[model samples]
Target: MVDNRYTILVSNEQFRFTRDQLESDPGNYFATYFFGEFAEASQGAKELVVEKDVHLFRLIQAHLRGYDIFPLPDAAIPPYMTKEVAIKNLHRDAQFYCLGKLEEKIKELELMSPNGRTGVRRDSPSAKRYKFGDETWSGLEWMFQDLNNDGYQLMLGKLKNLDMAIPSEQPLIPGFSLTFCWAKEHRYYVLLASDD
Candidate 1:
């Protein structure tokens, strides 16, 4: 007998949940899409693939398990994540999944801060918006000129060299690691390195 369970794959992670748990709320996107009689998932499909951040998918699962995603408690924040990063990731996932209510809730949370600021500001600049294109280089120029002109020129040269060898569709260079971090003197740094 086939078990009444379904596997949801997000990024490189797999999550299994009972049919009942996913169908508990009939109006929910997951429930409606997976359990409705005429739905594709209801035709004995055993697995669904979701191309989203695994961490955000875990939070979405928690929401399905009767946990509210908004108004996140301080205790729920992961050790390596700041609350702003957590909310931003959740918001992106919610938006991608067409979870309007969840997106609204996240937006609400984003607009308010514990200290009454407009929103949570990170000490480091967000590199999520960066892409592999001329526009990205332009944006980097604007950002880096304010930090270190020499470093910006070196970085641009490196990026141009990489661009020549790698296709635009391939954002990740084989051996290089890219990271954003805060630096001394109130500057933000984009660090890139290759194994060589």
Candidate 2:
């Protein structure tokens, strides 16, 4: 008999877990969708493909195995997994998966300022102008003549340092035509032209 275990392909990595382990919790989307009685049965070893970050998926898998998502005691996390990139990736994946509890935990981590405070600094002029609240920021709508490459880079750096989460959806900036450039190392920037 073909083993009933399933293989999940995430990004370039393949993860194997038994049908039982996957179905152990009814709350898991994979379990509910793949292992439910109305779901199609697999003839042999089943392969499911997921378009997600593999490293993040591993953390999600660990959560499925009854582990709490981050702020896990430092001892519980592998040294290589302690970086900000890993946490950001995991948070993005959790949001994609609609794992509400895990998403909340990751948001808490994201909101922590460098000094261990719960909020970001609101002192800078840019910070005062752009940052709306804990998460949202005002979209930029400066006239073309008002912003230059150096100024844009400085603004981006400020945002990065503040750990601001820029919204992926760019709403049309009134009276400004926007252009995006993907420079070396895949860095993205938006340039504006005055519609006036």
Candidate 3:
């Protein structure tokens, strides 16, 4: 991961980025200043100092590094911030960096925000027992087929974006496991798990 790193001082705090990482996006603000036909590029400066919020810059750098969503939003941002304030700060930095489409992606992530307003994630180590221990071999296609045969429905429309936004290979749905539970409303909650 270390490839001749460069230091960036943001709001009196130091952050580092490798050469390829600085130039990862050809059109991004920092990438242009470091590699484009600019005066800074001529000097080959090893460090950059910018006056910006450190927390916001962290989110921007994560975005530049191909990370779209934080697995847990609360832990990613400053602890003192409210969810709305954090989202606002993230949006501000995203626009300031001229991050194309990141604004929309951030909004998409905000929709799935698990901040106790609508839902939240609880880490139950015993929930590990639901780790697909007894299930026989079957792929997503076959699993969905079996669910349908059992009058269980796989809600594709709701899960599509959440799956892409989350880092896990297993999809994030109503419940967080690879087991199917019967709902009183005649609905099936099928949670998928992977050997992580």
TM-scores of the candidates are 0.46, 0.43, 0.52
1-196, model 3: which lDDT tens digit per residue? 7357777889888888876777655566776666677788788866788998787788777766767665436767777787678778877877776676667676555543323222223353432212111112232321331122111122344443433221223334334355432222322334343222
Q: Which is better, 2 or 3, measured by lDDT?
A: 3
Worst 10 residues of 2 by lDDT: 127-136
For residues 14-115, what per-residue lDDT tens digits would candidate 2 score against the true structure?
A: 887776667544455566446644344433327778897665677777776667666555544445776665776676766665566677666555443232
lDDT of 1 by residue, 28-131 (tens): 55665677654675586777887866766777787666667666777666666888887877877666656666776665443333222323233334211121
RMSD of each: 16.6, 15.5, 11.8
Worst lDDT window (10 residues) for model 1?
126-135
> What's the distance in Å from true for residue 30, model 3?
0.6
Regions of candidate 3 where Cα sits further than 4 Å from its true position:
1-3, 111-196
- Whose lDDT is greatest here? 3
Clashing pairs in model 3, backbone N/Cα/C closer than 3 A? 177-191, 178-191
Query: lDDT ranking from best to worst?
Result: 3, 1, 2
TM-score of 3: 0.52
